[model samples]
Target: MDALPRAAPRPHLPAGALGLGALLVLAYGIVPLTGTSYLFEALLTPFLALALAGLGLNLLTGYAGLLSLGSAAFMAVGAYAAFNLSLRLPGLPLPASLLLAGFVAALAGLAAGLPALRLRGFYLAVSTLAVQFFVAWALNRIGWISDDSPSGVITAPRLVVAGLSFDDPRGRYLVSLTVVTLLTLVAWRLVSSPTGRNLVAIRDNETAARLVGVKVARTKLLAFAASSFVIGIAGALWAFAYLRTVEPAGFNLDRSFQILFIVIIGGLGTLRGAFLGAGFIVVLPLLLARLGAALLGDGFDSGTLEMVQRIVLGALIVALLIREPAGLAALLDRAGRRLGRRAA
Candidate 1:
């Protein structure tokens, strides 16, 4: 067989820009080590976890052209899987439990992908929705999942590694950052590989990919499995680092939609978009809410604040789509080119 043509190289930030970014992150990590700021540490963990999940979802929807609405289900699977692993393998460490959880979620993702062989478009989206609901219902029905409790919540045990406890917010934040960074690097590598090219080909045109001997169905399934595995690990981290409790409600449709929105607003086909999008989703609301409260004072209620937030979010999405459908990354790229031209 002849070799496939190489894909165009991805546009990356300049080395100087990358160095600066790394320095900033290093500062963030080192500053907390001096003394913990519970608020900043607590906020950073969830932000990183959600961003990781968004990156996984972007791999499927943005790169592979597979629309998945059951991401939250995979997340739920990871959380429960971790819970069960912890209980069943009492001697196993937290890291091992997290890995097992990701594996379990990947299996679930593979099972969910089986239907994609025959489904597409709205049908495919609906089928994934079934996975979401079914997993949620199953979690509710099983007493073991709930630990025979009425509320059906699973609290993560304290993370003790090599005699060091990550119970403190600072320790947890560092762990989460490390996990996120490693997973993001892995995702970056995966997207630059041959398999990633196949996914993009499948996404751009399935019929053309088949003509080139790409196994369209198999590739799609692989994409889903890989995407879900990453998402599942992110969910486990979320449960352990942020929530410390897992419930079915935590992995609802809204969660899936939120991830989708992040990809759409950040940039559909890029990893950097995932981080930018997650930051927007997580940070913007809080900022807006605070601004709203300051303006509305005691007259504002929670319902009103929520309504305003939705309106603002919807408006921003529409504006971004209309002005720069390629998302924030595109805008940044254009700006960078302009600056370069001016300098030259």
Candidate 2:
């Protein structure tokens, strides 16, 4: 008797950029077909918006050593700006409107960041609170911003692009996927360039960065602008794709806090952490509700479950800080290394 010859080893597929591109193609091409409305509406859309928000905040806080409590304020600026641009300019494309909206948001960010020159840490954070309050007040009191909507809540217009309407969940999801992917790539490129190094330099030591010929003031402002641009787009997506409305009250201090939490929980100065943290934040509440119903049966109540979810979330955040200060991305890297060792 003779042993059968083993089949030739399977060829390994491409990795790195090519592999990542393929994964993205798979996600964009297949996910919508297989996913439901709930998946798009309840999870992916919100996650993309929040993750993008986290990414923007990380650029300023994690890399540029600036603090902000006015993220949602910038978002409102983007949302309302886009709304107004598209509303007034009937011939303009939605994407163009959104782009202009981002610029508006960046300008607003620049204003909010002005106080950073004389402030840092908690003081900087407090100064940004002024931006938040002012933005909220303006949106509420200014009828022009809302187009004089009776309720002061401006519902998003048709999510149309290239004559295709992105009014449904599937369409909205695709829009978000495209926008988030492109922006994430841009962010990666920015962070990989010399500007990113300057940011890191500033983050490490302001005086040292200045001594080394880095224009600390200019760099900080540019960082704020770039971050605000991304966040502004995220804001547009939040209103147009997820919430489908631009209400000042809706994007309040809590929204800014949530974005901040996402950055902290995801990990500072890491792009992957943004998405990972957002996934956790968006999915946790739904998961908690499902688990509560499953375990507690019919006795569980919505209000009670909401409280439990918050408690659990707080506890988990504390545990994560204590156990892995670097956040979920660090945990993932550790796990991957362990698995690779076993595989080898």
Candidate 3:
């Protein structure tokens, strides 16, 4: 038989890409089909939002070595900006409102980062605190943002897109998934690019980065802007998708600390760290509550359980920082290598 021309070899996807695709299938298809409605509304949706917030903080603090205590402030900016845009501009699309909200938050980050040029260490951290206080105050005091509601709590408008309504928990969860996936891809592209290298260099040693002709000031500003932009989108998701309402109290100092802990515990400078850390933070409480109930039964009061949870969480943070400063990502990586070696 005449040899037919060989067909072109099928292109294989990178393992990372294949793994990511499989994860997406699991999240979007399998989870929706098998997971409970309460899980979608209470756990997964909020986890995605918090994870995205951790990713944003990771960019600024992890990659760029900037210290911030007001991550929640930027979130507030995005949430309120998105809320206002969607409310006033009836013609604007929901995604457009979200993008614009991100821009607004970016501006706020730039303003907060201005003093970072001259400040360092504790001083810089304090400067970011100003942003946190200012945003909380504005969101609460500014009646305009809340549309003059007496309670300062406003319900998110219906999620209607292209004549489809995503008003239900499942639909909202899907939206959160889509947003996180897109932003994560963006973060990967950024860290893989020249800008990412600059961020790392600056983080390691600002003086050396500047000596190497890196625009130290510009890079810092860029880091802040990019970080805030992602965080802002997360805020929008938190408000519109997870919380389903805009409240000043939602993005508070405690919330900022939560996000910081997520980055710290998840593993600095690693993207997957955000997700891992968020899962830990979100699931740990439930686990502890269950454990307490199982062990102590009615003797373990809910209030006592909450207090114990916080104490255990603090102790774990200290232990992790001292023992595995690289975060859970490093630990997982080590385990994977060990398994591979054993298999070999």
lDDT, candidate 3, 1-344, per-residue tens: 55443322211112367777899999988998888889999799999999999999999998889989999999999998998999899888888898899999999999999988999878999999999999888877889988998757878888877788998889899889999999998987787678988999999999999999999999899999999999999999999998986678889999999999999999888888898899999999988998999999999998998899999999999998898998988877778779999999
Candidate 1 local accuracy as lDDT? 0.84
Residue runs of model 3 more than 4 Å from their true location after superposition: 1-15
Colliding pairs, model 2 = none
lDDT of 1 at 136: 86
lDDT of 3: 0.89
Q: Write the per-residue lDDT of candidate 2 for residues 95-125, one digit (tens) a residue.
A: 8998999999999988888888888889999
RMSD of 3: 5.8
lDDT of each: 0.84, 0.87, 0.89
Residue-level lDDT of model 1, residues 87-181, one tens digit each, is: 87888888778878888999999999999888887898999999999988988888887577665788888877767898878878777777787
> Between 1 and 3, whose TM-score is larger?
3
